[model samples]
Target chain A: MSRALDTVAAWVLGALWIAPLVYALWAAVHPEAYAARFDLAAPLTFENFARAWAQAPFPRYILNTFVLVTAILAAQLVLCTLAAYGFARFAFPGRDTLFMLVLVQLMIVPEVLIVENYATMARLGLVDTILGIGLPYMASAFGIFLLRQTFKSIPKELDDAARIEGCGALGLLARVYVPLARPTLVAYALVSISHHWNNFLWPLIVTNSPEVRPITVGLAIFGAPESGVSWPLVSAATLISVTPLLLAFLIFQRQFVQSFLHAGIK
Target chain B: MRIRDWATGYLLILPAAAVLAAFTHLPIVRTVRDSLFSRGSAIRPARFVGLDNFEALAADPVFWKVLGNNLAFALGTVPASIALALAMALLVDRKLKGQGVLRLAYFLPTMLPMIAAANLWLFFYTPDIGLLDQILGRFGLPGRNWLGDPATVLPCLMTMTVWKEAGFFMIFYLAALQTQPPELKEAARLEGAGRWVYFRRVLFPMLMPTTMFVLINAVLNAFKLVDHLFVLTKGGPNNASNLLLYYIFEHAFAFNDLPAAAALTAVLLALLAGLAVTQFALLDRRVHYR
Candidate 1:
């Protein structure tokens, strides 16, 4: 009897959870008049998508997000790899002290330092640029920490063998450490991509023009109640911003799940 | 011919160190320094006014209110979400029919951007035409202004937060659960342990580390994740739902008061550092027991 109760409770909770997304789907595809109405016979139309598209610079915003996420990921992966490699393999002077400073970023995230970071960005002449939005996040402490632990676990014999085979530090890192820590890389990349993709406040402050503002910022402007857009259009815009990550997640759900698991476990 | 390996290591670490210092370490110093100064004009320039900004912060009613709201927001959202997440993880970890579908359903919220989730939830709170009110109408109830009313606004934001976060935290618990030894469960069953007993004695204690981690994260996130405020409340219907970070954003960007913003940011950093210390202490205690 309790087994039956548990299954029933689980299914009910699941349905309640997805009801919003389902509502978004319902409201977006139907005509504005039918958004709140639950008539099973509500006519479906792509008009909301078309109107929402015409109304906002979603394409440009999405392009900006794509560029930002990938750039940050690329920079983080490279920077973190080198840093993690340094920490894992060699005994550098002041390495522990520097590592502790880097770990400070974990506690004092970029979001908290917005006031001063913005000043630094202005000094660097990076304001209103995608680079400004991405720069503060590029040297991710979490990524370095995750990768350092992974790099430390690799067999020492392999490193010695690679060194004997004419692999310099950089070469060994590129060819050996990178490949060995692929799972950690994958895990960090997944977390980083999703994180920067969804990141808002920094991007909102840094990017003013539609040319550089990410889809999240763009969607915020587009759906701000003051804009007077209807629910259908807002839902459609929400769907557009989310569809890429949502689809990637659904298709690679298992890996997506495991990637977070891997990232968290470390 | 190769350089000393330690020297090479330093060279390898230079780029990340430079970036981290520029963004994190330097800004930290600047925030502290700036907080101690005046919001300068062209002629005046930034002059030292030690603790004046903090004095202003201390006296500001809105700051106190936002802090109170943040505390309530954390209090309302974090524990509920953690409990819900644990329950959801337990549900999915067992042998169940259609578990994949249930997992997908629960995890969908974590995939959507906060702005998008905020936009969707805004519709649900849209007074008369909102989904919540529409459901209420079926019972002949009148719809209250959910986001527009001050009393309801923070709770509304907290509800949306729980809805958004529980699923994300669930996956962490789920991950932790899946990695545990099956033998533990078998042994408990052999000893005729009830579900509640096994949960209290075995699962709960074992999941303590994950719980602590998630708890700390959830608390920090309550302070950090203010994206929904931009969409849902803008910290309004009279500064009712404003949070610390959003308040800082307003000070710097909206009001263009850099010194004031820096002071607030300093407070936030101190709060975060205090939490980090507490996390280490708790983790240390957990380790001692283990």
Candidate 2:
């Protein structure tokens, strides 16, 4: 009896959890008249999506988001790899202190520094640029920490072998340490991509023009009630904005969870 | 050889160090320094005001209001999501049939951007013509405005947060649970311990470290996760649902008051520092126990 009760409760909770997305699907597919009605006989149409697409510069917003995520991920991979390699291998003065300073970013995130960073960006004349949106997040402490842990676990024999082969510091990193840490790299890349893709506050603060505005900011502007909230059209746009990540998560559900787990273990 | 090693190490670290200093470390110092000044405007340039911004913060009712709202939000979300996440982890830890679908259903919302989730919830919260109202009307109930009224807005937003976060938190608990010794469960069962007894005495203690990690994360998110406000309420109806970060965003960007924003950021930094200290203490204790 208890076991059956557990299953029932689990199913109910799951349904409640997924109800919002299902509702978005419902509202998006139906006409504005039928959005709240949910009548089975009601006809479904793609007109709402067409109208939503036409109303907002969603194409441009999507392109900006793509550029932003790619740039952040590319920069993070190179910078974190170099830093993590250094911290994992070298014995240098102030190394521990520097590592601690990097970890400080874990607590006082870029969002908290938005006011001051905005000023810095303005001074550098980087305001309203895609690079400005990606700059603050490129040197990710979590990524460095994760990579350092992975790098540290590799036996010292590998480093010695690579050095005997006339491999320099950068070459050894690119050839040996990085290859061994591919799983960590993939995991960090996945996490970083999703994170900066969804990141809103800093991007919202930095970018003023539509050219640099990501989907999140664009959606915010499009869906605001002041802009005339049409339930069907807004739902359609929301689906369009989120579908890429949602589809990726659905396809790679296990890797997504595992990557988050791998990232969080530190 | 020694100097060469130092040069190689320092060179390898320079790019990451430079960006971190420019963005994270320096901004912290600058934020504190800027908080002591007045926001320069067209009529007058910024001048050092010396604690005036903080004094204004104390006097500002909205500051206190948002602070209370953030605290309430943290209080509401952190425990509820942790408990729910634990329950979910336990649910999926079993060999239940069709559990993959259940896990996916719970986690799907986490994948969607908060802005999109906010838009979807907006449809549900629309007065009179929303999904929620329609459902309520079926039972002859009147619709209460979910996001418009101050009384309901924060709670409503909290509900969305719980939904969005519980699954993400569940993954952590699930990871922790996987690392547990299965023999303990079998031993407890052989000893004829009830499920609640086993969980309370055995499972909960084992999960404490994960709980602490998730708790700190949830607290940080309580302050950070204000994207829903941009769509759901805009801190509307007299700043009823305004969180601290969102309020800082308003002051800095909308109102163009950087000094005031800096002051608010300082308070947020203090709150984060408190949480960081707690995290460190807990981690230290855990390490000692091990």
Candidate 3:
């Protein structure tokens, strides 16, 4: 009896969870006339996707999203590695205070400072630029903190051995630290890519032109109040926008979940 | 070796520090300064007017309303999502047929972007023609205005948020559950304690740390995350759903009131700091047996 009850409850929750995705897939593939229809026999079509594609510059949006995510990840990897190295290995003055300040950024994000940051960007003439969109997120507190924790776990003897090999600081980092931290680096990269891929507000605030707008903002424009959104088309566009990340998750679901758990545990 | 060590360490950290200073630290300091000054216009010079922005905020009723709305949102979202997540985690943790598939299904929503979730829910809530109303019509029950009515807008937003967030939080609980020893649970069952009693007495105590983590994360998410508002409500029905972050966005970007936005931001920062301090203090006091 207890086992039956547990099975029933699990099925209900599972349905609640999977229903939306199934609904989205249905809406995206079905014709507008049949969207609300619950018939299993309803013929699925791809016309909504074609319409959604033509309605917006989705190809351009995907390209821009790719650029934004890669740029941010590249910058974060370089910056976080250095900062994590400093905090993990060095004995510099005010290191703890500096690390704390960086950690504080984890709690207070660029979204909160959008107004002042906008003015700064305007002043610097970076408004509507890809650099402006990606600038604030390039140095992530979460990344720095995560990498620092990972770096501290490595044995100090490794660093000493690298030094005995007459390797310079850069060499030691490139040859020793970076190689040792591959799993952590991959984990951080995955987390960063997923995050920036889904980011909206800062990018929306920074870019005014269609040329630079990422997929999130591009999708928003389609769904804006002024624009009349057909449900099927909107669903199709949403599916398009999320496809890459979704595909990535499907492929690396284990790594993705493990990375998040590892990051959280630290 | 020591010189090389110092150089390597400095080199490793330079790019990240520069980015941090340019983007995060410098902007925060600039925001503090900007909050003390009044904006002349969108493109014009800002003039220094120390604390006037804060004083104006104190007098504005909308500020309080939005703050209250945020509190209401937090209240509605955090506990509901956490409890739902906990329940789902417990359900899936059971040894049953097709449990792996069930776990994957529960976690699928977490992978979808918030913007997409918001857009989907917006469709779901559309009056007369939407799925929800269609379902209600079939049941002979009255459909709600959902996002269109002030009374229901916040709840509508909360529901969407809960759907998106619950699965993500469930992962944490699942991880914690995996680490829990099976002996205690089996021991409790052998004693003839009912499932609810075993859960309340044995399992719940083991999950306290996970609960605290989820609570802090949920509260942070409540304040900081408002992406769905852009598509769903836009703080609509006479600003009934105007959360603090959305209000801050509007003042700075729409109304071009930098100082007021900054002042509002300062308040948000203070509140976040207070929450963090309280979390630490509470954790310090709580004795985790596991």
Per-candidate DockQ versus the true complex?
0.86, 0.84, 0.67
lDDT of 2 by residue, A48-139 (tens): 99999999899999999999999999999999999999999988899999999999999999988888898899999999999999999999
Assess the local accuracy of residue A34 in candidate 3 as a C-alpha lDDT between 0 and 100: 83
Name the best candidate (by lDDT). 1
lDDT of 3 by residue, B1-290 (tens): 66665565566667777777877788777777777888776687778898999999989998999999999999999999999999989988868899878878888777777888888888789888788999999999888888889888999899888988888888889999999988988899899999899989988878888888888889999998888888888888888999998999998889967678889988887788788787878678556554
Best-to-worst ranking by DockQ = 1, 2, 3
Provide the RMSD of all predictions against the true structure, rounded to 1 decimal. 1.4, 1.3, 2.0
Candidate achieving higher lDDT, 1 or 3: 1
Model 1, stretches more than 4 Å misplaced? B1-3, B190-192, B288-290
For model 1, residues B1-290, the per-residue Cα lDDT tens digits are 23597788888888999999999999989999999999899888999999999999999999999999999999999999999999999988899999999988988898888899999999999999999999999999999999999999999999888989899899999988988999999999999999999999999999998999899899999988899999998999889999999999999999999999999999999999999999889889778435
For residues A37-128, write the lDDT of model 1, one tens digit per residue: 99999998999999999999999999999999999999999999999999989886788998988889888889988888888899999999
Worst 10 residues of 3 chain B by lDDT: B1-10
Q: Pick the candidate with the highest DockQ.
A: 1
Off by over 4 Å in 2: B41-45, B288-290
Candidate 1 positional error at B253, Å? 0.6
What RMSD does model 2 have? 1.3
